[model samples]
Target chain A: MTTQTTAQAPARVRLTQLTRGQTARLDSADFKDDSAAHLTAMGLRPSCQLRVCKAGQPCIVHVDGHAGGCRIALSRDLAASLYVLPH
Target chain B: MPPVTLPTNPVSVTVAIRTAALVGNPNVGKSTLFNTLAGLRQKTANFPGTTQEAHLAQVQSPAGPIVLADLPGAYGLSLNTNESRICKGVLTGDQSIKGFPGGKPDAVAIVVDATNVPRNLRLAGEVIALGLPTIVVVTMTDAAARKGIKIDAEKFEAALGCPVVFASGKTGKGVADVLPALARAKVAAGPLSAAHIDEWADAVYAKACTAETRDHDAVTDRLDLAFTHPILGVATFAAIMTGLFWAIFSLATIPMDAIEAGFGWLAGLVSNTLPAGAIRDLLADGVIAGVGGTLVFLPQIVLLFFLIALLEQTGYLARAAFVIDRLLKPFGLPGHAFVPLLSGHACAIPAIMSARAIPDFRQRVATILAIPFMSCSARIPVYVLLTQILFPESTMLQAVAFTGCYVLGAAAGLFTAIIARRTILKGKSPAMALELPRYQWPSLLGATKTAAARGWLFVRKAGTVILAISVILWWLSAYPKPADPDDAQRAAEVSFLGRIGGAVQPVFAPMGADRQLTVGILASFAAREVFVSTMAVQIAGTDDAEGEGVRERLTEATRDDGTKVFTPATSWAMLVFFVLAIQCLPTLVVTAKEAGGWKWAALQAGWMTGVAYVAATIVYGVASAIG
Candidate 1:
């Protein structure tokens, strides 16, 4: 199920729903403290486009172009906490 | 107090030295920058409130030679871990927390990954708001250029209100410019609130760097697919670990043997030079041999660190951690424990020290506690002694038995950690977000420096503690000597250790250990390999075999009842006990320091001892029945 505030404003989808090879834009993350601060610091911010290189509870992501971009691993807990809009 | 206060001189204040701190996210080339700046002149010490050690160095700049403190990599001001919080305190100049010489940095070099502009800019914005003199060091420009992304430093600086330098540690490109930028660093006012900080970073990045482009990288994608394929990832991780150990064993054996021989020759010289007295014995047996025994494992430690540095440099470590995290998380051990756990095969001291990199408190402790059970290189000799006793001439049997010890030790480590995580060090396993740095050539000089530091700290910090315990053990075994002696065993029987061994013999009788074996076990508490030397003295008169090795004569050594000492059940039981036991006092000392206090150390020692005894007893019962 996908929820959208409006067509132009990005549809809301759980980050876990995005599989490997799928690119998505991060809308918001539902975290408060360490996890939130950590994710934000790692560049999983709203409006930032990221592609899933590998998907699982702990997903691997490459921001921007897959070649020269920063590749980071996120834990399942972090994955579930994120809200994304897939492209 | 009032009467004594009159003589107090004016408080002498030491002039504060200007210092810069290197701060950034992990795998963002922060360390490379630090190493490039500091070279081999770096010092590491634990920051207050956490086990994470801070690296400080003195690097020359045009402005002056400023002290550089490489603070732990962190995202923003505050985080859950004590490490990140300590970093926050350092940046905020919280006088209550100790980090730098002046309680805060004069300037901070924010090493940003150039490819991740927005994210790096986000951190840059937050730091700029702190009002510290800061410079944005854009690293990996060479790699960034390959993807058609160009970083305009002037535009970035103009927008962010600070200096920005496009540098690559790999190529040493624009590093000189960084020092000057750092010299002229000044905190530019940032957005007032967190919400606006994002907007500010987005706006600045838009003007400063090329727009984001999304496309598949065939090489990286193929590598990722191969490395992270669920089943293949596990297999790859295991294969890599096997390769690591194989390299450690094969590459380190030559140096290990040389160290052993060198120490033996030194001990021989000391023994011959001095008269046959307590002084000679103390110098040769107590001091040289005791210290040399622990130092013998240094080669393995250095090699392990060197290889781990290579793995981290290649970016495969992050993937390895991710793949293993799936297996570890269910056990309540986080993925990051892999480095410490893997390194434990070399030695536990370095393993415990490296556990500081783990961000989560309970997870780090769990890894620390579990490390000693990883069957380090020190336990190899003891394994050989027991295995040889059981399967005298069969090389295949000995090899098989050796492999079993490793498997059993790993199983024990995992089992104990799982139980501890669930029961004592109870906390939800925090999600770990590890950055996969771009694969590049591992820096040999940097790795060597790191290995040297770890080895130096091992000897300098834990060495004295081990030497002290060795001296005490030596004294206990040497004291209350009879006026004359015919055989070493007879001499030992009349000694203080002999009496103590007799007193404790009944406790170990179920494991088929005689009093002398009990004494060996007691001495082994200092270190595992010491058991072989001690057993040689108590079982046979000559502790040092020289030309004729102990291996040939050990099979013929017997107990007092004329019963053959190397019984199958007893050898296997002792082997099992040695496999599981916490025999290294130095490991305990390090754990005490690393795990915060002696409380956790005491628990670890007591529990491991208790478990080893029970497991050994069971092995003895079953083996005796089968035999």
Candidate 2:
């Protein structure tokens, strides 16, 4: 169930730009292969809503029950790979 | 994700459940449950030829005693790492698995975190979909209750078409119900399609759980703000690590001394009771010294692992990992490398094994290569001796120099890893994405089990590989029979081992090592601490060594022309040498097993020796200039 905000369609920015406590839906990420598959497997995929738990080099993001109520920590490079769109 | 299929009928169920494999992701209280069920009937075993280990224990159930195999924690069936690969293989009976009583598990139990049902079920659904005779046990009911979460196990079981039991490892709530539930489960005829696994888990959660629509955990929120803060987190991690190392060093001294004294008493008794022959000498020196040398480090290793396990259970480790990611990534390692690197101070063997925590293979290898250079407790005796030889009368100088040795060792290890990443074995650093599990009270039994498992591995290694090496070295020096016991010193000089040492002496002369010091280096291949005892025999004219008074004997001993052998230059060079050298044979053995092969182990030893030699030469050159 992929949802598209027509007005914000081209506004996919990196997750690194997300502010702390701000929730956004992960549209897609530049990552592919194992990196891409890993995010999907961890349930951070298109239309998955995640909140920024902590920001910086190693960032912690919250997928509060929408994906699995888990907090995932991603290195800055990995987080930057994930493109997100604000709600 | 790769989906694995289990055997349609792996075990024949009877009046008693013969075998069951307990599998789950990390932080699911899998070990706690296993410990509660197994009590004291547990033992650790290496999974056959693989470096992976498992805890096997037989627990009495209402039906009968069923042997439970506690597999390593994993996130999914996809084989990204050894831990996950091993779990999938064990559950599916695809590999020739070792350490289990039965060739394959007769039944399987998937532990689902009751508090985090949706996420836990992501794996639970996959396991249930494997068609193995399976039962789902919901744990952390107490923790979930505190969060105002409720799970209806019966409804959850109805949704999954399997048996579900709510159990709390913390309070021993509903633990006895697990075996009976497992006895009733059988491999389903038709497993669910993988495509709808999440939907199935969602459906199960919808039917079986309820919670207040809370935005976040206030406790976790506050803790995270402090623990994940850039400046505060680093300070806290440093403080915690210092406390841990301090505990390991200070607390382990009592047991270390006790072990040393006991081994000394045994050696003395052997010499007193047995006839003075090769047998007596073999038993005393070869068997006792070799095994005893390896075992002496056991207390430090056990304490190191115990503290690590305790910290890991509290969930602070995840935050620490996050905090240290900045430091580790630069060296081509993940943040999780900090624990193993810190633990390397106590001993490198367990630290190498614990490197498995860093999910990436290349990073894990890099961490293993760099670990031995981290000034392990085995190296401390060497550092102290060399530091003393360099600064005999100045205790303050000795302390400062000893601290400098540790700092130098760490810097050298980190740089070595950077070089390793740049040169051979060059590859992309693994992606970093880890779950930060909620902080909880550390499990005491789990910590004990972890310490005991590692401690047992040390003892076993000593029993097999180390014992043989110790005995072999004993024979080499003992034979070529010294013409007279009184001329033992002169006779040893021309003996087989002596010739080997003398042959290598000139090669190492630039670093200022004399023939006797070269022999000490060769002897130390058995263990780093053996350097002291070897020097005592070769130079001090006694077998007793260590901080007690070997400094005087070592500094006073001289060579031809009455030139002082332990000049400040040589002593400084020696300190740098031991700081970088791979002197412990047992460490290489563990490295071989953990790093996947002997080639990596050899590379580690060879590379470290090369580095040690070059660095020691420079130290010698500089010190001689000052002299």
Candidate 3:
């Protein structure tokens, strides 16, 4: 999933670097234990497109995918763990 | 991914009565649908060994009477959370979990949110792979329509190899189809492997659902901007909390006063009808007064729950949690602790039970330990008496003192949480990852049902214990009656309770409390509000004679040496004491059960009493020095 989207992007940066309203594709996520699996189950898989709604500690993001989009709020620590490629 | 075990007998028709479990993610309208389907036949129950609560209801289906288990919502059946564990256990027929109607449910009803179908589909797939007779109930159809999302149930049903039913719990639409669907439920075709479940869900969702160019919800975005703003959010929370509490206190007064007056009248009737003796006294004071004291708070409890349900239904509660998370993180509490702590202001029994919402055990224990320190409604009568005594001439000072009591209690609770987290329960707070459900108008009927259930639960769970303790205290005080029964003070002096108070008088001597004050303090352990009536009996020989008369007599009452009993220092000490003391027995029992150990309850009681004793002594010393 990551190769399909990241192959087309010129640059990748941490999710925290994305500003409000910026769209990006999730490249990968680094979480301890089952946190990564839990995030994936909530529809934040690699290659899933997301748009930053509120960019800060406890940031809000809209995860858009083929199935439809849902809004989620992530704490600062969680937001810092995700790597995303700007669309 | 964890290995998913598919149940062998998904369509087991061997059981005499069939059972089905309602499974879904949190905020998917599952609860609402359950309540609608099983109206008045449901009861909230705790899953064995865990603090998680689920509702079980029996509904009559076209095929037979089916018992519906409303399992706690989870993100997936394989997650580490208690919700997921319980869901998995029940679905897989884990017989070790007792108290469930059926050891393992015969079927599973997977509720999927229409608006957020993609996110909900993974859980649905997991349930389907269990090979259980399953039906996908697509809820929030009305909300989905408003969002310009359409779900083709035929395509979804065909794609998943199960019947798909669209329902809107809010509008009572498609609810009638649930039972019928459950009757005709069938296990889906070959199970999807654990690794491929997510892929299968996404593919199914794509084929069956279409969205009309979804745009950002402008109203929600604007509301979130103000609600989640740092300074603005805090101010809004404060204002909203103030309004909530103010409404509870003010609106509940009428019903509270009525309950009190009704019981007072009952006590009077008991006294007048019975021949004046131990029976009359027991009926009037021990039974009527004892039970009524606890029942009077029912209005406050009901009102608090009703208001909270409304707030939660509006989806603002998630934003509130997000905002409060910032403040509570430093104290080592997760944002989820907000509701339980807020509920503690009304009563600690329910508040402690509500702590099950905290997923982490250590965090839940910390929250439960800190809850009793909040100034519960039980302490109001004591506060009213003490603040008035402290500021006899000025209402402004009394009001300030009253507010200070709440502030002091809240500060003590928070500080205790901080200290506990740093010392015994040491861990960094877990980062919150919450899905903010879309906002909607709250259901008044649902709020009413919740308030009714909570209010009744309080009475049912705590009522007997309170009555039993009050009766015991009455026996201790009424026994060994003096020769002159007419003299209430002399009888009290000779009774077991009075002698016990004399024995404990020295312990409180440093706080300027005499035998009479000591007796009042000891009696208040039954319930804080009992202090007023106990003082009336101890000092004035009758509790029925209420008002300024009793207050004046108590204020002017003298010790054996003719010194005033209620000294300035003693009033201040007692005020601080009530604010910090763990006086309610039901709260301790609940803490023990909910925290899963007597040691935690002992720790909570010991720590709180120690704090109260030391704080009260210090207050006494300072007041004496100032005077």
DockQ of each two-chain model = 0.51, 0.48, 0.57
User: What are the runs in model 2 whose C-alpha is more than 4 Å off?
Assistant: A1-3, A8-13, A43-46, A66-68, A85-87, B1-17, B48-50, B60-65, B101-104, B189-192, B391-401, B544-550, B560-564, B567-569, B617-627
True contacts kept of 1: 0.62
- lDDT of model 3 at residue A76? 83
Q: Can you write out model 2's per-residue Cα lDDT over B45-84, one digit (the tens) per residue? A: 6666556778888877777778889988877777466777
Residue B335, model 1, lDDT: 75
Error of 1 at B211 (Å): 3.7
Model 3 score (lDDT) = 0.82
Q: What docking class should model 1 receive?
A: medium
Enumerate clash totals for all models, in the order shown: 1, 1, 0
Compared with the true structure, the alpha-carbon lDDT of candidate 2 equals 0.80
Clashing pairs in 3: none
Task: State the lDDT of candidate 3 residue by residue for B107-132, as single tens digits.
Answer: 78899988788778888888888878
Share of true Cα-Cα contacts across chains kept by each model: 0.62, 0.42, 0.46
Ordered from best to worst lDDT, the candidate numbers read 3, 2, 1
Pairwise lDDT winner, candidates 1 and 2: 2
The stretch of ten residues in a row with the least summed lDDT in candidate 2 chain B is B1-10
Chain A fold similarity by TM-score, each prediction: 0.79, 0.81, 0.86
Q: Residue pairs in steric clash, candidate 1?
A: A57-A76
List model 1 lDDT by residue over B1-627, tens digit each. 111111112122222327888888777788888877777888886676556678888778877788888877777665565756766777777723243476677888888887777777666777777878877888877667776777777777777677778777666778888776777786677666677777777677666677455445767766776776688888998899899889888989899999989999999999888899889999888988888888888888888878887777787877777777877876678777887887888788888887876778898898888899999887888898889879877999999999999999888899889999989988777677877666667878777877888888877853678788888889888877766655687767878888899999999988888888899998888788888888888877778733246766677778888887778988888999999999989888889889888998999899888888999889989999998
